[model samples]
Target: MIDFQPISPLQRTWLLELGLERAFLARLPQAQPGGQSAPVAAPAQEAAAAMQTAQPVERHLNDAGSPSPSAPAAATDAMSARDQALAVLRKSGARPVAAAPVEEVVQRPAVLIQPEKAQDMASLLEQVQACQECGLHTGRAQVVFGSELLSEPDWMIIGEAPGTSDDRSAKPFDGKAGLLLQAMLNSAIPNASVYKTHLVKCRPLGNRPPTQEELAACRAFLDAQIRLVQPRRLLAVGHLAAVALSGRDEDLETLRGQALTYTDAQGRSLPLVVTYHPASLLLRPQHKANAWRDLSLLRELQNQP
Candidate 1:
């Protein structure tokens, strides 16, 4: 028979922490203080009852304060499984890793555009609408083609990749910025036949800059557009467009107002001008004067023979 005497508060607290309070209470005597001792349970019976209702305390600690055999085997099996997983990962050259951010790599591939067999703009548009050369195609709502073109375009305005609004509408320069650009063109060169497009047709997720690979992939389409339009002058409206068309890695301010020429795949040279994009001008209205000056330059170039 097991006889348990009254325990101190601290001892009771320790037992509670070990999840043994219920089992301890069950073993407590029901006898009154002045009455004779109540019947006691056998040691094995008490242990069995405790095991049914309370945690297995002996597995966590024994008389020697060491883990039991069952406990050690369980722990060893868990460690062995973890080690085996790590070994497999090591053999396969793969490990748990976090996702990396998408960024533009420094080494840009050489800009190469294979002249498409499609000579007309309609045939080229069909090809561009179904282009899947880059990853941007997967996430795009639709491929944005340029606005309607005249038989002979006076100015071919090239902007950066499509934005959210442009992507949704499937037309280049269809948003507020587009409106501002149209206004600017009307105010600067009235009745000028203009065709607007972007460097890349598809919008980058979250309007982030297109990667070099994306730029290279879409360069062919842009070259094809230039060939088909045969515009007398080219207008590159943003830093990226300016750099790509001029092939100069200088600042926009440096490239602005400078005489630049864009040569197509067929060895045709057209006057190219760099200017502030309408989107940027919207944010920084102070640069409107600079943009106006750029327009003046474009106008001057147009007036020349």
Candidate 2:
């Protein structure tokens, strides 16, 4: 037997919203002559018929013209299903189905590899001479693969990117800023060789700031260098280097005079000392005092056996 319960005012209101009450009542399954199940029309066919009528459901009123609970169980169920179908259609309106046109997927080419710290730097440099990993590689006069100390250096210096001079010479930090960096390194670790590198191998256009996309592309190379060198302490000079090492964008002041720790690929925490970029001190001579304090702290950490 069909479950015929009295409809609630809420159900009647909802059925009226779907414009399905009349059509649903018309298509409800009727009892067969024999004691067999009545066949019902497919939901899709009923939905199409309701769409064709497109007329709003008429409201039932009492003698005082107030809404009444007269909608049947079959009507309520059909209305609920129609509402659910409408909701699904509306939600998927923005997505493409099988009927939608397909577009071709264009894959980007892989970047050229330049293994500067591998067994041989010259062979690796030759390989990356025609690199096109990113747009910067195309614009650069020469790729600054970076330099490493021949000796077992206790400290490593990581900089932001190749400046104009570094790009010209195919070396890192060859400009005036590089000179200041060398001086700072000499004072901090006199006997220790200062290996220099740019976070990005290629020079950016007009020495403009490196975009986040470019940094992401070059991060793996920097990480590789850190692993190869295995320095006791790392000196991150400049905002980009500091952020790369610390995984945060804390201010230079908060970063200075404090020893921060970074986890290496082997799950080992490496000691990192933050300091003002040589370029910064050159521009703001007044902050030299703060830089000296940071340098002092780095020396103390290095001396720790």
Candidate 3:
């Protein structure tokens, strides 16, 4: 039988820093038959449900037109990505993740998306499901193109590649991280749908970050998404995607707390914001205050010219 004990916040941090947390998660079974290994879609209904559960806090503009109370004053920081995911699993009384075999290499036939013909959303969805540009498609149970688009929301949100829950549910913001993301968006961009997507469509076998080749293979789809959404603003959730979308090598910390602009290949310039991934927030709740600042900035920019 597995034993989990209560630990202080400091102890939890120490464990994570020592890689004990990762080691624990690693030792877990490679598959979770009844656990959250399934991909989840970011549901449109989530926005409504989140809004109902957690009514967004009101923010009034000051004379200078800045949002008041930028972030939560205090938040307990005992959770990390693994802990959050595991918490959800434990809560559901779900089975543990499957034990994965060491040194498993996946091979897949190379295939590509027809960028030009993917002119509309419907065509793109059709093509994305069948795409095998990289090895990702071989592992994912389904493709989560985007949960669902609601008429080109004001902001186009992009995140890193899929995790187990995302892969299992084929939902952009599925899982515990997704739960937090929905709360963030509902509380912040109450009137708007996040229209969140990923750098890569398919999961990277074991929740691993997508490689440059994989991201490159999927760039056309993102560009097409940009064209289709034509959003006034852009929000990148994590460091990899923030750097990838911006085509920069700067560290994520340096990129935070600002609203920059990114011009697409078609010369459309959109206001952009960067913040910690919700998964990061689940792992490090302390950053939620900072993420609030980022989302606040996104909110402020979207209201601007």
Put down candidate 2 lDDT per residue, 1-305, tens digits, no spaces: 22223334455445556564455534434434454434344244444444433223223435764334785554545454444434433444422122234588998666457554444445455545545666888888888877854444677788888889988898888989989878876797677656778788899988886888898877766776666666777888888888889887888777768889888877878788878888788899998888888888878887888
Estimated TM-score per prediction?
0.62, 0.59, 0.62
Selected candidate, larger lDDT, 1 vs 3: 1
Model-by-model lDDT, in order?
0.75, 0.67, 0.69
Minimum summed lDDT over a 10-residue window in model 1 is located at 76-85
Residue-level lDDT of model 1, residues 218-278, one tens digit each, is 9988988888888999999999999999999999999998779988877888889999999
Candidate 1's TM-score reads: 0.62
Worst 10 residues of 3 by lDDT: 50-59
lDDT of 3 by residue, 1-305 (tens): 22333343454444355344343433333324444333332222322232222212222334664344553322122222234445444455554433345696798754356865566888887778877778888888999888677676787889989888888888897899989888898888788756889988888886888999999999888888888877778899999988987777899888989977788878888877889999998889888888998888877876666
Off by over 4 Å in 1: 1-115
User: What's the C-alpha lDDT at position 164 in model 3?
Assistant: 87
Off by over 4 Å in 2: 1-130
Best-to-worst lDDT order: 1, 3, 2
